[model samples]
Target: MKLNKYTWIFVGLIAAVYLGILIWVRLTNPVYLQKNMYQTWENSYVMHPKSDQSFVNTSKNNDHQNPVALSESQGYGMLITVRAAQKGWANQKDFDRFVNYWLAHRDYVGDQRQTETYLMSWRQYYNRHHQWVNDINSATDGDVYIAMALALAAKQWPKDATYYRSLAKNLSDDILSYEYNPQTGALTVGDWVTRDSKYWQLMRTSDVMPDIFMTLAKLTGDSRWRTVNNTMLDRLVDLSRLHHTGLVPDFAWITRDAAKPVKPNAISTKYDGDYSANACRVPMMLATSNNPKARKVLKKMLRFFSHQQYITAGYSLSGKRLVKYQSASFSAPIFFAVSHHRGEGYDNLFDSQKYIFSKPLTHKNYYDATLTVMAALEGLN
Candidate 1:
């Protein structure tokens, strides 16, 4: 059949439009492209099976095997809402539902006469009996992200700004009161007020998110957060120096000396000062900082990883590979590191992203997926 002139014109127009879109997306900043692709990939993992309001980790790591982590769910909600606002996608309803679920289930400690409301349980476990069991202690990193999300939501939605800001402040206050170590001028890994004294001695380097601290400082007019931020920066450098490889350990031991404000005696013996899962986030956190020192540390770490033929899941402080298997969680953060520095390791960022993008997110691996999202977002920023 002979096509009409109008039909031929329509076909040409459609093809041109499609090609234009493809070129536009490809020509856009790589980080922005990554964010768009990551958002598409993340849609499959963010869902609620039981409560429409709440999201579950649902990755192979947690689905049916363990209870939902309030921290993880809240973190996911915050990330979604913040990204939605940035993209002008308007996701307030879903964000509100998530906030309500956790607010209703907020954890409290102390006796009936003297109770304190801490953050929600860090870990929630679903048993064979089909009940959710809540772990008492809270992870400070989760709390920080939730509070930051609330603050961002307030900024994004002006109509609910007052309510969201108030909630964020309350959460921030709880974090400051319970998690901040005045002696060390750093945030603890968990809630110190509720946990035993022994637990306060150890600090997770990844938990020292400078961006969150700076944001809270600006929002709350509190200099303590800024102080913690500085302390963490200096401590990161010190820890790297201690290891002599610019790689931080998963956990470091904090000892209070009369002469000094806070001293990291050594990497925690129990946690072993290794460049493992928790430590991998050091670069991601540092990449958020505009400080030159942070950049130096990140560049050093990225260069160390660049020498390896293949990035592994874990490593020793002395640049020894601990795990043979490569993981998105490990590689994505390295991508962020290299992207930020544009130094000797800049080429590595693409290699890492290429490896990450090649793998399909079928396993629903919570850590891997979350880090992948974070790496993508950080690189864009």
Candidate 2:
């Protein structure tokens, strides 16, 4: 049917009004902005191969190859899903799918029925037999994040709180039992770390998550969690004293009296001692804590970054930039830290880097993409 000129004009006016309202809501409502960002991130990485399960696949490596999944990524996805669900951007089913994937791929032995530990197997892959398999060991950091997410899920959904809380309690206990060093009060790299292992004394600096530790302590009524939190906080202080810029290493040796950065090629790469990929997360992680020592650590980091023209991908302990490229993983954390702790005169610095989050997420870099959205969600509050 043909419409008259006046009717067409009315239709155009209604469409314009609708578009304007959407733009206004997007610009003025942080929740709407966050939900939009979360949806983009979700659609980019989260995959559902079947009706009941889903996973966040790892992005291509330097070789341009990909893994089926990483437990670390699983933990990241679960935490983000649950947090987004709290904001109504996600739902219980979305969170449950991530949890189901973790359940289906837990650390195990010869038979899938035999549970090796509550901790998740760190990686998943397609075996030569065309069957799916997971690495036998568990990364402590992944376990920590998964446990924290479960605890949070319990609080977020009352009807299923018992189930979530039960899982959280068991995982938390196993983490303390297998991954934590009671004597040193430090978290080991993974479940494979034994006392006799040379790396047993080593702790990934990024594994020092005090806020998560406090949550676990409350969930399980464990004083040791408090001790672990304090021990790592003290280690950060000691490590900070080693450098004027207060940069931390990717890995550190936790001795009886001190925490020291590892030597080059000591753990993973030549940048082990440098503030590289792993250590890049320290700022955002510390930003989550209210502890005075945590705040002190962040202050030192912000001071160093604030003086820099750009926050590059990597840095040296002596405050030298290692890479010219900027990364969301590095910048988002600094942005979150600067925005989180206001009135420190770093507002201008925060403004400078806030554009990083506003830019389109790099789908090839899942770590950066996930962390960027997580930081954005955190900063929204």
Candidate 3:
């Protein structure tokens, strides 16, 4: 059936109005746009487990094929929600749900299910048996972020300061006990890594979050946190100096004298040794630090990123581009990094990517959307 001219005109007007609304939203001020994005992000990803309404589900985004929750996602959710609460968009109730989800999924020791570890299990999934199961291991990245969130919550909501601080201190202690390499002062990937483990010396570049480590140090008064922060910063400087592009790899092996990119397929994937997804967070993480060493590392990276014609998904340490498509995961961090510096060069870089924070939500891109929100929260302020 053919539409009448009136019907065709009506359809055209509807499309035009929708397009106009999209443009208006994209052009709004940064803070307002960020709050909108955060709400959309929360609605799209945050879920409550059917078995336990009190616990939060962090991996309900469309990207995953089955329902699940990752410790990393929980960390992100907790931090994001805590910050959102301070801004009046999120509440203590939801924040408590995230905390409860973590508590209900703590990492265990052995077959008897010894639940001594305060650290959280890395993943929660529904098995084919239709039961929720945890991986029962801890990832340092997730643990660090969880500890940081708790510490922040202690200060942000003083009514519950004592409780949050206690939890933060306990988890921070365990992270030091199990995750830190005492001799090298570098973070191991997880509690599963022991002194004799082959992966003990491997460090993921994005885990070099000096500011968060410093926050943990101040909260717990642990001097060892300073060692972890300084050692990682030194390794980052060394890695940046090794490459003309100043790009850190997804994974690096740290020795007493130097840190080098891991060999391909050494850990998770062939991109493990390149500036891939994991390494893309380096810029935003480094931007959070006040140390001159962090600045030195970011300066080199800014130089490389500022000159890029298009920031793509992956690159080599030697300034070689590996992918053709641009990604918000890469650009948003660069945007945040540029926001920390002052100069005509940096300003232009910031302006070029400011629209990324305002991009309407896309389906099946959980990583990209999450990072974009994180970047916005940090950079827009």
Candidate 4:
């Protein structure tokens, strides 16, 4: 029906109000919860800047104190890589020392529920608190080590296919259970079986994601996994591009109100994003194939990783974006990401050899990523 000038004015007003409400929800609701929750290490205006990450002390060793052990039933994927690398480097003694030291401290007892799902590190060391309050975050945690380990195992030693198959399938199922509403473009995780259940946990991109999940998807021949994982990648790109802090929301604070902007907050922990893992995993995803889009993401990750703070022992200097390097943290993933792009091995798939070299040829958590670079280089020919 045709409307008069006054009628049109009223309709426009109503539309403005509706749009305002939508913006409010996206910025303030659960979707935007993270922005207001944790005190960012980079920005303190949002929350009271506490003693969260006051300074940088790379020499500070966390070895003397035994961290809360995570899990023991699994683990050993990277060790195998080390086992293989043992044939090349004489640093076996040094690496094995860490491996054994970690093994001895595996969180085998006390608060068994607090143990992590995969990886030989995080859980076994003291995490103080647990995961986020998002289902997808929880699910991601639920299958981290299992997912990553399986992919590495399959890629490195194919004979272990059966070994990694069941584990990958199980971990994928767990990770998938948290993908209930993928329409919002988010990856969440958490388990909920009892009153003590932490059903939700949210997080931005980390080393434990993308590459591992994508690898699992390929191994299982399940496009669902790839679809969900890629959706995660898309959001990551958005956050990397949009967030003013050069990072993404660390806390999930999920609600029907996500997909909006964030607000200010109070009890801010070290809840900002980190370029280290994001730079590593995003580009790692590109090494498998030659997708032009994936290559772009890979290149972006390289630029990002090159800017982070890496204290000596392969630890993240701060949970925020990479602004400077004050200490000597042995950041190996940086090398690996560069490796894939430079094509370090016999050939060149991603041109990893152009950047990654022996100067910072770290063998820490980067071992897995390095192997990926090698494969990409070999596949190039």
lDDT of each: 0.69, 0.85, 0.84, 0.37
Which parts of model 3 are misplaced by more than 4 Å? 1-21, 50-65, 110-115
Q: Report the error of model 4 at residue 270, Å.
A: 4.6
In model 3, state the lDDT of residue 75.
Answer: 88
Identify the runs in model 2 with alpha carbons over 4 angstroms from their true place. 1-29, 61-67, 109-115
What ranges in model 4 sit over 4 Å off? 1-142, 154-160, 178-186, 192-201, 243-292, 301-324, 327-331, 343-381
Model 4: per-residue Cα lDDT over 267-291, one tens digit each: 1333233334223333333445454
Whichever of 2 and 4 has more lDDT, that candidate is 2
Task: For candidate 2, give the lDDT.
Answer: 0.85
What is the TM-score (0 to 1) of candidate 3?
A: 0.91
Candidate 3 structure quality by residue, lDDT tens digits, 265-318: 999899999999899999889886889999888888888887876678899999
Which lDDT tens digits does candidate 1 get at residues 5-64?
889999999999997776566435655555565565446545544464665464455454
- Which has the better lDDT: candidate 1, or candidate 2? 2
lDDT of 2 at 247: 94
Candidate that scores best on lDDT: 2
Residue 248 local lDDT, model 2: 90
Angstrom error at residue 160, model 1: 1.5
